[model samples]
Target chain A: MENLIVEGSHGVYFVPYVNFNAETGECELAGESYLEDTVLFYNPLLEWLDNYINKKREAIKFNIKLTYFNTSSSRCLLDILNMLKDFEDEGGEVAVNWYYDEEDIDMQEEIEDYEIDTGLHINLIPSTDLVKHQEDDDDE
Target chain B: MEANNLEKKAQDTNKFDLFKYHSLFNQNVQISYKGPFDSKVLSVLGTYIQFTIGKNPKASKKIFNIFIELAQNIAHYSAEKNLFGVEEGVGSLVIAEYPEHYAFSTGNIVKNEDVIVIIEKIELINSLDREQLREYKRVQRNLPQREKGNANIGLIQVALTSANPLDIEVTLIDDKYSFFAITVKVDK
Candidate 1:
């Protein structure tokens, strides 16, 4: 399996950032997502996780840092989180982290809800730390 | 007879002005629009809401998120549509600024039969307090999304994001059609 990289867009419709590394088994989805066809956008990401779990069977670290997502996109997110929980259940090493704006009460509650719904220990980090790390990565 | 006709014309002009500037009654309305509701409309209004409301990013984002959900409801569920090749939701949206809160509202036409469902959804939302509303949203989120229309989670979202209870009103246009309006107020 090859790496899947999608640059997020902000236009007539918002698109979230997606970066899935086949070699390292590290995946990240960030930014806002409100697409014209949401299912079309998220299907491939779900497929990537399926391939990683069924084929690679390696340790996976998933990170989500979304500022806003519509209700439809939220469902797609639940699918991704549930897949991670399943992988964890199958003795696959999976770690999921969700970074949200500290000031955003709704996003914080949403992360908590995802944790409760999936029964996965999602590490909730503030966006400021995420940004700082990204800047450091760019510098390196 | 000429004087009577002049008086009638003057009265008509006054009525037109009153109708046109009805918003003047609440002069704090920061933004309002009446037209086809679509993705383009959301994008434009979303940007405006983000940038216009001072430096409070969280409040602006909340307003924007609430606006998107409500406006999308109109775009998807409104019985009235613009038939210019591709159909579009025909409705009106207004965002008013108060010292205590910002009120976002959308109104559109719906089939008389569908009004009951919408009212029930609003009533259910209004009944729940914040924590219950959150729980309700979680449960509904887990349910299967409808194949054709909204997953019926939009009102739940409005309830969660807004500072006050959801205000829903329906006016009968005729036996076949009715106008449905819902408002959400976000505190500053």
Candidate 2:
């Protein structure tokens, strides 16, 4: 399967950067994710994961470092996590490391909620650098 | 009732008195707009508010989160659709500052029949604490795709983001329509 790479945009709506490397089994989503059409924006990435898990049947490493996302996009994130969880439940090796802003209590709680909702063990990493990441988002 | 009182009081005093208790048009008003709350308008307002609502980053984030949900709520559900044939809803939004907090409010018209259900939902949301609300959101999120109700979930997110009770006002315009306004505050 071909890899998926999408350069995120910060125009009238924020779109998160996505990169799913099929060869290496490494995937990442970063940046703000508010979008005009959240499902449309995320469906392709979900399909890519679908293809990776089904066709390759290999180890998967997912990294998420979003600084902000609307509720609709949050639902899409859940969809991605649920897909990964399903893959892992069927004996596929999967690891997800999630980075959150240290100062954002609500974001940290949001990550915790994801763990509870999807029954996935997410490695939560707190970083002060997320503030800097948001700065880069603004520059875009 | 609140809207009617505000109108009567404004006409009586010949000034811009608001809500009969608090003045939303005071010098602390940061941003105010009345128009179609489509995606483009929300994007511009969201960016501006994200950058310049208040000095506190935490508070600003809360306000921005609440604003997006409320604005989009108006965009999707407001009864007033003034964009010709499109569904771009029309509404009013305001952000004002207080020494201890920042208040964000959105006002729009709605079907008179919906007022009771809306108020009941708001009260139910207000009754829950942070933990309960989080649980509510989780269950709502995990529901099967076909049965998910996004409109209620939007308001739940708003309440969760602000961590405050929603101050809602409903005024009967006639037999068919009513003005619905809701406000939330973020502590600075």
TM-score of chain B of each: 0.85, 0.82
> Per-residue alpha-carbon lDDT of model 1 for B38-146, expressed as tens digits?
7777778887998887466767888888888888878877898887754778899888888878888889999999989888888988998888988898899888887
User: Relative to the unseen true structure, what is the C-alpha lDDT of residue A98 in candidate 2, on a scale of 0 to 100?
Assistant: 93
Cα RMSD over interface residues, candidate 1: 1.5
> lDDT tens string, model 2, A20-131?
8999999989989877777778889988999989999999999998988888888889999999999999999999999888889999899999999999999999877853
- For each of the candidates, give the backbone clash count: 0, 0
lDDT of 1 by residue, A39-139 (tens): 88999999988998999999999988887898889989999999989999989999888888787888888888888888999998886644422211111
lDDT of each: 0.83, 0.85
Q: What tier of docking accuracy does candidate 2 attain?
A: medium
What lDDT score is found at residue A94 in candidate 2? 95
What lDDT does model 1 reach?
0.83
lDDT of 2 by residue, B1-188 (tens): 69789788778989954454255467888888988987777877987887876457899888888888888778878899986676788999988898998889899999998899999989999999999999998988776543222424788898988888899999899999999999898888
